[model samples]
Target chain A: MPDDAAGRPPVPGSDEAFRALADPTRRRILDLLADHGSLTVADLVAQFPGLVASGISKHLMALRAAGLVTAVRRGRHQVYAIDADGLGRALAPWAARYEAYWAEALTRLRAASTGTAGTDPRE
Target chain B: MPDDAAGRPPVPGSDEAFRALADPTRRRILDLLADHGSLTVADLVAQFPGLVASGISKHLMALRAAGLVTAVRRGRHQVYAIDADGLGRALAPWAARYEAYWAEALTRLRAASTGTAGTDPRE
Candidate 1:
């Protein structure tokens, strides 16, 4: 579960988001969407000419599962667009919470190390 | 690698860092080390009494490999402390680069969507 300050619900799509982010290929797909707006799977496949359509499609499925992108039928093609708001909603909370926690921990650690009543001996 | 802005050497230890952070238990261990100052493995073991010594040890080993924490000899005990500076150096660049990339993408996306020559038709 995300720490309390992340404020988002634990049971929602966060696990999938994390799983999607764990792969570099998925991140690259997000980058492409972010740069080029909506594009069909063919458009994305064009960007990676060496890779077959099936592999790119697999990455797209992972991104969709993570709520990072939205797909809509455009006549014969399925167009995919970055859901920037959704990505922000999913990621910022977790990152912000961790950043805050680390900041607080560092502050406390500094205080303890510097204070006259130093709690732990540094040896 | 690391999208350029995460300037640390790719070969040094990034893959390990990513792998280490992929686990929640390891993150929690880093959290505990952060909250408290340096602690011996025994001290950490005391906190998670339900789990056996070996499990926590495994988590610690992963964190150590990732450079998130440092262990030092203190008499007969091995003390572990959060390597805040190392973590900041490792994570900040990556996060900052992504944040900048996202900011740019959002700006471009907004302009394209709002302009008279709209780049993509929302269908």
Candidate 2:
């Protein structure tokens, strides 16, 4: 069963959005979508070797549920596209917070590595 | 069974690290650890309302497998702490790439929104 079945409401802040991104296959899908505007399921599946089409379809469903991608019917086939700025809007804030945290941590690490704790040479 | 059972080798670049972070509960756990140092499972469980202890234990295990936290046995109780600079080392690179991508996209969006597509008024 999907973890989203645990009655977690589909809020923008929900984990489902992030969880949908944790898979490498899905990340690759996003990269492909970013590079190429839209692709059919058959074309997307061809990007991954040794994986069955059914598995790719399931992964696509997860991405769709997370609002990361949209599937549209183009005649007899469905085409997938990265939802207009979907990840940029959803993940940017989350990543920005962590980026600030890590930036400070990295600066501290560099200072510690150089034995410059509490000493500002520019002073 | 865990999704990591797919025989994908545990490389730092593997999807497991990102997958481990896709959980909101785990993100909350990280936030708690950042605010307060080491905490035992019992202490951590108190932070969440209505969640069973065993479930929290499993969540911690998932975080541990992702190398996000370190658990040490203190007598009968096990205390977990955020691994020093773990996430900073792991997620910084990934998030940096995406940040650059979004920054450029945002710049473009702002330009497009302002109707400044190919005209350099500064000239």
Candidate 3:
């Protein structure tokens, strides 16, 4: 669980985080924010020619709820930026475990595919 | 794209993989298969107290589509097992990138949180 400004429980990094990340569009938004630091909704929407403003807003909301992005009031526009720290932390453990598993599996797969015995090409 | 048994294009490792993994029930199913090697549908369903057979079947379908598990006909019963190699490969790259990002962010965060300068405790 995350804490709010007042240290209260904040709904962040729940299954919603992965669900929000499941979308290609939202993933693109994060990529954009990562590359450009921050952008207004209009600016972010401009990057996707096929997406409507409302649709992008909905995506933004999902990202925000997942703590992947932070929306700030910049004058009249709500600017969004990648909350890199939060997003990175949220994904770390999941990635580390899977990476290790895959690395081992890939090694085994290579050895099996090559028909090599005893050598253990995976090592 | 993955290849079919006949070397045709098989749908595997698509967004469907992540979507299938989104369900906690399905994840638990994978975990069970990993632990038990293989089990019949009835056996797998018995592990879950409240879930219905149909629901578990649906989950099994999703997991199969995602290449997370494989089903084999053992007489009348359909036995399920974790497709460890496929599932492991599918999650590897995604996990690697996110883990690297998180590791860097954690380093920065620790420095900030401890109010230490120059030392770069993250290393």
Candidate whose lDDT is highest = 2
Please identify which of the two predictions, 2 or 3, would achieve the higher lDDT against the true structure: 2
Highest DockQ: which candidate?
2
Residue pairs in steric clash, candidate 2?
none
Q: Best candidate, TM-score-wise?
A: 3
CA RMSD of all predictions: 14.2, 10.6, 10.7
lDDT of 2 by residue, B34-115 (tens): 6677999999888776576998899999888877789999999999998756666666545543565456544554456475
**Model 3, range A7-107, lDDT digits (tens) per residue?**
21222353567788776667668767877889999998788767679988999999998888999998999999988777876765344333445666655
Of models 1 and 3, which has the larger lDDT?
A: 3
Query: How do all the candidates rank in terms of TM-score, highest first?
Result: 3, 2, 1
Better of 1 and 2 by DockQ: 2
**lDDT of model 3 at residue A90?**
71
Candidate 1 residue lDDT tens string, B1-123: 224332223324445665676665565576677668788889877776456688778888888877788999989999999887667555543454345324444454456556565423122
lDDT of 2 at B83: 73
Q: Candidate 2 on A58-108: residue-level lDDT in tens?
A: 999999888778999999989999875666666654553355545655555
The residue pairs that clash in candidate 1, if any, are none
Error of 3 at B16 (Å): 0.7
Q: Which stretches of candidate 3 lie over 4 Å from their true place?
A: A1-13, A104-123, B1-12, B104-123
Descending-DockQ candidate ranking = 2, 3, 1
TM-score of chain A of each: 0.67, 0.68, 0.69
